[model samples]
Structures are given as C-alpha cells and as structure tokens.
Target: MKLKKLMTILLTTVITTAVLTGCGQQENAKDAQKKPLKVATNATFVPFEFKGDGDSDYKGYEVDMIRAVGRVMGRDIEFNNIPFSGIIPIIQSGDMDVAASGMTITKERAGKVLFAAPFYESKLVILTNKNSGIKSVEDLKNHSVAVQMGTTAADYAQNLGLKTKQFDHNAEALMELKIGGSDAVIADKPVADYYVATEGKGEDVVIPIPDSKKEYLAFAMNAKNKDLQKEINAAIAKLKETGEFQQIYKKWFNVDPGDLPKTAEETLQ
Candidate 1:
C-alpha cells in the first residue's frame, strides 16, 4: 500500500506538470500573435494621409487603407510621421515595419525595399493659380515651380529645367503657388485636384503634363521582412476582393478604384 501511494502521487504530479506546460504554450502563442506593427507615413498629403480636419490624428485615404491592412494582418499598427525622404531609410534600418505615405513604387525604390501590391494609381500634373496665365504644360517654362521635396514631381520639374522650389510637404508647396510665391506647383493629379476641390475656391487649376506616365503607389517594407511583406500583400488582395477597399477608395476619390495589382510583381506598373 505504501508503494502504491507513492506511485499515485508521482502520477498526479506528472499530470499536473503536463497540463501546466500545455497552458503555458498556448499563452505564448497568443502573445506572439498579438504583437503590434509599426508604420511610417508622411501625413502632409491631402486625401492620402494628413493631419485631421481637426481631429489631430491622421484622417485620410491612406490612413483608412493602412488600418484596413492592419486588420487583415491581425495586428494593431502605430502610425508614425517621418519625413517623406526618411521613410525608405527608416524602413531599411528596420525601425519601421511599413511605409504608406502616397509613395510611388519605382524600379529604383523597389530594388531597395520589398513592395507590396500597389494600392493607388497616379500621375504627375501641374497645379497653378487660375489666373496665372499658365494654360498648358508648355507655359510652365521660365517660371518657378514648387514641389514636395524628394517627390517624382520635383524630379520632373528639375528635368524640365524649371526653377524648382522644394518644400517638405504638398500643402506648403501648394501654399507657395496660392500666395504667388511660386508660379506653379507640380504634384500628383489627385492631390492637385483634392486641393482645388476643397480649398482652391476657383483660384487653382490642374493641367496634365503631356507624356506623363502612370505611377503606382504601394506599401513598402524592409527587404529582410519577406514574411511581413507577404502578409501586407495578402491584406491588400483580401481588401480588394471583398469590396471593402472600394468603399474606402470611393470615399476619397468619389469613384471606384476598379482594381489594384493582384500580386507583388504586378505592382511594378
């Protein structure tokens, strides 16, 4: 009977240990799955990401889009404001997990980072005051142009030999044109249109730059994080497939986005 009692005590001890071990593993899995992601975005672009109309926190298309991506990623995201020029570097340094600042994905940039599927289709255009006497792209010559620093628009303006005035944000560049500090502002078509619609008060005009090519915008991650990039790509795909993305697109663009890139490679457009 003494031997039997000792055996029974040992069996109970082993069983309890097993149960506790299983519970600890389960808790660890939950903790691992609940880790939050950090995102970098420049919020000075209208209709994309911007300081709220009064809310302070971000309130724009990319803000809603990134949050949706986070939901599909099964992680909460903390959006941080980095300068547009610093976003890529921050991602490269692994300090940021994502970049979604109306960033245009190009071969040069894609070579440095892992790009998810494109979320927005865009083009560059010229923005000027309505009475600035600039009716066409050709008329922009010999005039100073304001541009958001480090943007394709600035590159385009410089390549064309225009006097370039670079600012850190689109709002500031547009303001330069508004106050007659610059002859015009070259920016993304949608951004120029958004400003004209919301605050231009019939004083601004958007003109297409002839021969401008289409540009695609996507969330970028550090090249080392392929798994995270896959997760982000899946999030974008799922959002588009379920029609949730369209609702958000229409909210800002006033029209359907139709479709976005289906895969990472397709985003190269």
Candidate 2:
C-alpha cells in the first residue's frame, strides 16, 4: 500500500510540473510578442528631433508625435539615436522597427520601405550668406553647394548639375556654408528657415527654390510592417481628429496645422 501511494504521488508531481511548464512557455511567447518597438532617429534635425538641454531627452515635433502614437497604441517607444544615412537600412534589417528621422517621403524610398501618413509639408530651398547673391536655384549652377548626405536635397543638387559637397549631417553642411567651404547650403525649407530665424539670423538668407515641388515628410518602417503602418496611420488620424496633431505642430512651428497629404504621391487627387 505504501509503495502504491508513493508511486501515485510521484505521478501527480510529474503531471503538475508538465502543466506548469506549458503555461510558462505560453506566457513567455506572449511577452516576446509584446516587446517594445525600437525607433531610430538622427537627433540632428532641430524642430524635428534634436537633443534637448541638460540631460533631457530628445525634444521636437517628431519626438512628440512618436510618443503620442505610442500612447494611442498602448506600446512603448525605445529610441535609438543613429545617423540619418543608416535609418532606412536598419529598418530593412529589422534592427530597428521605425524611422522617426523626419524623413521626406520620396518615390524611391517608398519602394524600399512603407511610409505612414504624411506629417509635415516641406520643400527644398537655398541657404547662403546674404552677401553670396545666390537668390535662386539657377544661381547655384556655378557654386559649390553643401548638402546632407542621404537627403533629397543632395540628390536635388546633384540632379541640377551643381558641384555638391555632402556631409553626414545637415548641421555640418550648414556650417560648411558659414565657413566658406561651400558657397551655399541646400536643405529642407523648414530647417533652413529655423536656422535663419534663430542662429543664422542677420547673416543668412533663404532663397526660394524656383519650380520646387511641395514635399511631404513622414515616419517609415520596414516594408513588411504593414500592420504597424496601419496602426500608426490610424493613430495619426485620431490625433488629427482630437486636434492634438495641430497642437503639436503649433507648439514647434508656431503655425496653424494645414491639411496633411493622404499619401506621399505628389499627384494624389
């Protein structure tokens, strides 16, 4: 009888262990699926995503917007500061899940990654010293222009047959313009305007690029992240509906939020 009772107890203990092990495995799977998203940004673009003063985290339009999206999705955002050039490649490799680098949506980039809703309206412009006399895109023909590598501005300059100097960051490219290493700096309209309004005041001038088409900027992710793209787009739409999107826009830009493009395609009806 003693032997039989001992055998029964051992069998019960084995069964209980197996059941608990299965439950633990299932819980681990759930936890893995809920892992925080890794967001990559080059914290060099002011009013977009730049490091704040005194041990503060990144503060800018993109940073705020990403945080808002994470809140609406009930997901946590894990920020990784990286160079703007590597933003896309890392997304493709699954090293990062989102790009918050204030990236302009281009047809070529659209082919490589999925874009969320367009957030900011932008265009290219020329930034130069007031004494440089570069008032138009045509004026850049014979001048050495500085541009941030991996940006549409660089491609635009190259395509326009201008002598171009590429820098890893737009700030450096702008500095090159200030130091006379380049005759002019070509950058996104908003960034140039920000510099002109703040640090570049009195000494710098922004020339509207003639025939420059309107550009849209947005968040991008791996092409395979369609579900996440939908969630983000939905979150942005909600933010717009709640008027939070415009609030954020006004906070950084001090301007009314205009209607955002529904898609990146320039010809959208």
Candidate 3:
C-alpha cells in the first residue's frame, strides 16, 4: 500500500506540471495574436481621410487603401487620427505602426521616416476668393495669403515674398478667406478642390496656382519598420495593377491621373 501511494503522488504531480505548461503556451499564443497594427494619420484631409459627414466613422481614399492593406497582411488595424504635426513624432516614438495621411514624400520627410513607394502625385495650387483679383502666383505678390502653419505651402509662400497669414489647419485658412481676413490661401490642389466643391465655395474660390510645382505623396513608417514598408509597397503595386488605383483616383477627382510624362503639346497647352 505504501509503495502504491507514493507512486500515485508522483503521477499526480507530473500531470499537474504538464497541464500548467500547456496552459502557459496557450496563453503565450493568444498574447502574440492580440497585437494589431496601429496606423496614425491626420484625419482632416478630405478625399483622403476625414470624419464622415453626420457620423463618427472615417471616410476617404486613404482609409480604404489602408483597409485593403490590412486584409493583405491578415492583421487588424487601428487608426489614430492625430494632427499632421504630431504624426511623425508619434511614429518615431513607437506609438504608431504606420503613417499614411497623404503624406508627401520629400527629402526633408525622408530623413525622418521610411517612405513607401509614391502613392499619389499631387500638385500645389493657390485658392483665392474669386473677387480677390489673384489670378496666379504673380498676382500673390501684393496680397495676404493664408496657409496652415508648418505646411509646405506656408514655407513656399513665405519664401516667395508674399505676405502670409498662418493657421493651425487648412480649414482655418479657408475661414480666413471666407471672413475676408486673408486675400488668398495656398494648399494642395485636392484639398482646394474639395473645399470648392463641398464647402459651398464653388464660385467663391478658384485655383490660381498652376501645376509647375508638383509633389508626390506616400506612406511613412518608422525607419526601423522595413518589413511593414515592404508589405505596403507590395500592396500598392497590386492595387495599381488591378486598376483599383485609377478607379479610386477618378472617384475622388474627375480627371484621369496624369502622372506619366505628358506630351509636349499636353504640357504646353
């Protein structure tokens, strides 16, 4: 009897240890799968990412593209709608996994974040009240132009000898134009066009600046996230090849994308 009792105790101890070990491994697997990708972006840019009218849900081209990326990676995504100024810092500090707010891929930005392949080629344009008499960059010489603080538009206008009024967001600059505090506003062509079409300012504003100054937009990941950057580029290539990219482009802007080199006649005319 003593021998049998001793054997039974040892068997129970071994079984309990095995069960605990299996439970721990199961918990570890669950923990590993719980980590979802987090993408940060400035949600104020329309036709890219913005609060859907009459709802809290986000709606825009960038939002759709990122969703497609999540499907490709087989991972869930969480969007952090931060300000443009905070996006780079958040990603650098490891607070976000990706940044994709129609961010421009410029030399200055490349130094801060790893950029994916160019997603959209954009042009900068100036917007002014139709009655403001500002028909071009040349006309901006004597007028007060408003741009969002810390924007490329602000920097470009300031360097070009225009009197600049800076605000925290493009909406604020547009407000300045509406209130007659500023004579004009400079911004990307898409945002300017969105404001004109959706903000009840179609006849009030016009794109005064031309396409001579164009910029390419891209996604940004932390410099350390080479894997994520590769995944994004691959997905973008797939999107382009399937004509989904062109469809999204036309859905937002009525024009066919003109990124490829234009003929001399097209360029001149």
Go through the candidates in order and give each one's C-alpha lDDT.
0.87, 0.87, 0.76
Question: What shift in Å separates residue 180 of candidate 1 from its native position after superposition?
Answer: 1.3
For model 3, residues 28-132, the per-residue Cα lDDT tens digits are 977754567798977777778878658788778778778776766667878888767788889899889888787766667777888777656678888777777
Pairs of colliding residues, candidate 1: none
Candidates 1 and 3 compared: the better one by lDDT is: 1
Estimate the TM-score of every prediction: 0.88, 0.87, 0.79
CA RMSD per model (angstroms): 3.6, 3.8, 6.5
Enumerate clash totals for all models, in the order shown. Answer: 0, 0, 0
For 4-97, candidate 1 gives per-residue lDDT tens digits of 9999999999999999999999999789657877889998999899996577788889889999999987889798987898989999999888
TM-score of 1: 0.88
| Regions of candidate 1 where Cα sits further than 4 Å from its true position | 1-32
Which residue pairs overlap in candidate 3's backbone? none
Error of 2 at 208 (Å): 0.5
- Cα deviation at 27, candidate 3, in Å, is 10
